[model samples]
Target: MTTDPKSDGGVTQSPNRPFGLPRWVIGVVPILLLGLVVGGFVATTPLAGVDGGEPLPDVSIDYTTLPNDDTIRLHVTNNAPEPVTISQVHVDDANWQFEMTGAGGDRTLEPLESATIEIPYSWMEEYDYSVTVIADNGATFSTTIVAANSSPGLTGQVVWTLTVIGFLIGIVPIALGIMWFPFMQTMSKKWLNAMLAFSAGVLGYLIFDGGFEAFETAQSVPSGYSGPLLVVLGISGAWLLLQAVMDWLTDDEGESRLSLAYSAALGIGLHNLAEGLAIGAAFATGRTSLGMFLIIGFMIHNVTEGPVIIAPLADGNRPSLVHFVAFGLLAGAPAILGGWIGVSTQSPLLNTLFLAIGVGALLQVVFDIGDIVRRTGSIRSAPNMMGFAIGLVFMYATGLFTL
Candidate 1:
């Protein structure tokens, strides 16, 4: 034993071989204790998505303040193929970094999903605030906003809004169609020819509207020409699909006319889908009033669409109730599906594709109607031309509402 004058001559505590423990074991005791401490820390540490820190991709970040609670929520919209990690959320810098160690506090977010991070109001200051998120792979996502103390109206209100705009748009026209076939049945051949031409005119207007929207949507992409190219391809694909159906089915008059009517319905269905998408997107983005207006506008347009769907069947043969219902479902149900998808994913390319398909179907339908009218030998008669003009005017006028 050794004594130290600083310790008032107390016995020194020194290592010796007198104890039972081996020197090698003593050498490793501190190391084992240190390893246990490190292991505990790692076990408790809340890592996002991966065990190791890594970057995440394809995430859209949005920040908004919760006025009632004075808390800020980070909304991360994940659109990647795989799950991603968002480890650290900080404001301004690490000085205002938040601890995200709570259960389900954004450990992992699945593909095409969303997660939220909440930061306390105490951390906010009266400067232009920026929130930065660091992923496990060191990918950083950041956004700037007015200070959290600002009035609530300045921030976006985030809500997952689902709408039935498509169904409302469809039902009006379908109801009108229920009265059409019987009412038109007793009319003379002159009226029938005129009505077919009118329906063709309605289709003519739709082609222009749908084509324009499709091209515009496409031009939003980096490659401006892609929009026009997609339009051409969509038209070609629609024509080809209809042609394939025609070749597979009958060439007989009744069956052929029925097929044509259904084809028109398919075209109109595609067009309505685009409209539904717009309505849904408006609502999804918190534009409730805009959605309502769109529904009203599209409803009027849809009412005219009913005539076009039934035009192919307007020949001498009166269609059964089953046929009317079939056309209605074929044309109208697609809008509802489109609305659902539109609200969930606002994909412009997909919308453009749908418009292009509608273009192809409607254009083909117009030609078929014209062919039928031509066969009647009154393609330019007063009734046909006057009805066509009236139909065209009606359709164009509907566009004036700016819905």
Candidate 2:
């Protein structure tokens, strides 16, 4: 009996599409285009509120600084849907004359626009001061400066200092942790499984810690950006994107142990990046004690991550020295980059987004480690359970130093 090439047992099959694209793309493209068109129409049309009520005013004090003994600088953003005109500035309940720069010199801020306002006033050091900004619509926004101090600026010497701190906090301890690979090689199968579970436990704690930080950071973002929604989107987007990438990388048998190790390292690296940002921000804001404590705390907390990255390869074919170095850098190097960014720029939106992404990625890594443990032995086994508990407790104990 002769059968058509495109038919299976008398059932017709759909022919391959052009360019080997997935069938779902055929439906998705049109819907996406339609959405874009509708969005464009709505954005271009200036429709008043449905109730015809007056537009509300929203302005955010992004940053404040004391440039000198007699100068107070403020970075302000107009988050309102309508334009806002800055009419007056008040310091400690007294009206003060100020100069405006950026976003048109007319002291008018268009929607979502930002400007810098400089007030010439003698501010006392170590004294609390409150500044209030008034717009033409009778709306007021205020911010307080506690123990006022000059903001730090980036210079050659400052850059070098931050780099050294990043290296010590982010790289040195992780390298020390990687030194345990040789000893881990001699462990039995049960012990190896326990170690893997321990790694998962450490990561689980990080997910909780990072998620909490993300939420707190979100509170600082401008209301126009919907900070809470941004966190949700960042977390969900990162989790789904990483999952898709992992799915693409897996073969018919599933993900290899080496790939899982690399994923763990990547997740840990992102977490370290957020840690570095915190350290940089603290130092930049003159919180020297806070920065010192963060450095000490992170040094202790990150050491455990090195072992976690190499745990999957403990029983497999031995990796070369280069591979070991690569793994360490992958798990620890982003702290340096994060420190530079946090110190150089003060953007709550960016900080919140990065923190959310780190939390999401680490959460995915925890699940991957759990799968690895399940494949080796029963997850509920005494050794694995005990190891998990110990790991969690160890991280919590080390984390206290930061607080």
Give me the candidate number with maximum TM-score: 2
If scored against the real structure, what TM-score would every candidate get?
0.61, 0.85
Indicate the residue-level lDDT of 110 in model 1.
Answer: 66
lDDT, candidate 1, 1-403, per-residue tens: 6556434235433355314456788888899999999998788875544565433365556334433335566656555667767777777785344434322564676665666667775434455667787767777778775543422221223222333455677756755764577667777878988988889888888898888888888764223225578889998888777777776888687787788888888888888788777665554443446556655776776787787777667665787788788778778877777767665555666788889998988888887788778877679999999888888898898776644
Q: Write the per-residue lDDT of candidate 2 for residues 74-160, one digit (tens) a residue.
A: 889898899999999999999999999987879999988988999999988788999999998789999998898765666677677
Quick one: RMSD of model 1?
23.4
Worst 10 residues of 2 by lDDT: 12-21
Q: What total of clashing residue pairs does each candidate reach?
A: 4, 0
> For model 2, which pairs clash?
none
Q: Relative to the unseen true structure, what is the Cα RMSD of model 2?
A: 5.3
Q: What is the C-alpha lDDT of each candidate?
A: 0.70, 0.82
TM match of model 1 to true structure: 0.61
